[model samples]
Target: MRKSYLKLFGLACMLTIVSCSLDDDRVNFQYTPLQITGASLPDTFELGRVYTVDVNILRPDDCTLLDQFDVRRSFTDTTQIRTISAVGIVLDKDECAALNDSLQDAFQFEVLYTKPYIFRFYTSDDSEGEPEFLEIEVPVKE
Candidate 1:
């Protein structure tokens, strides 16, 4: 009887383990580009100094959360240009609310090179389906 009870307990444990699932209802997060309305940058940058750049962005819905600033630097031999864009982590759930709200966000930028830096903030696509940007140049003060 004791052996039979132990066998039954082992079968129950195996059944419980088999009934558990690793799949969840939460959908996979998608990274999407957000629209940058405007940005507040300093007129000049000082070497080895950190500056806080305020950026205004627009989101499609409340389900989208700001992931980080997609700062892509140009690897060209002549130009010191960086493209500043905002990427959002989207949670595609059923209860997500749709709204178009402008949000203000800031990021820290440190000046390393002595040359002038050109920032291209992504706004949106134009009428011809071309990417538009708000370009600003900040020279390094020596």
Candidate 2:
């Protein structure tokens, strides 16, 4: 009787441990990775040409659709004639880091005016780190 009771107790303990270890795989995890593939404008633009700037966001390997905004852009100097639409996106830290490897070689637009033009893309939270800036020389159209 004593041995039987001990065996039952041990079995119950094992079962409890196993049950706790099993997580519901059916439940989707909330953590999703976001990334940016490329963001740029045309290489050349005519004077006083109004063009829309395109910012591209890439979907993570595990997800589809880049429908989030943690990325924003602003002109460093206000004296420039260029303007960006208010419809900018934001990206999370994880999402930003995922693109860090690829962003170095990403396409960049050249500022073609006499005034110094700087485009800055900042993370959602400034406290996270300093914002990234792209300085381009706006060439004066002859």
- Give me the candidate number with maximum lDDT: 1
Q: What's each prediction's clash count?
A: 0, 12
Give per-residue CA lDDT, model 1, range 52-78, as digits (tens): 999999987889988899998883565
User: What does the lDDT come to for candidate 1?
Assistant: 0.90
What TM-score fits each model? 0.80, 0.32
Model 1 clash count equals 0
**TM-score computed on alpha carbons, candidate 1:** 0.80
Which residue runs of candidate 2 sit more than 4 Å off their true CA positions? 1-37, 61-116, 122-128, 134-137, 140-142
lDDT of 2 by residue, 55-83 (tens): 54444333233333433344445445432
- Name the runs in model 1 displaced over 4 angstroms: 1-13, 75-78, 127-129
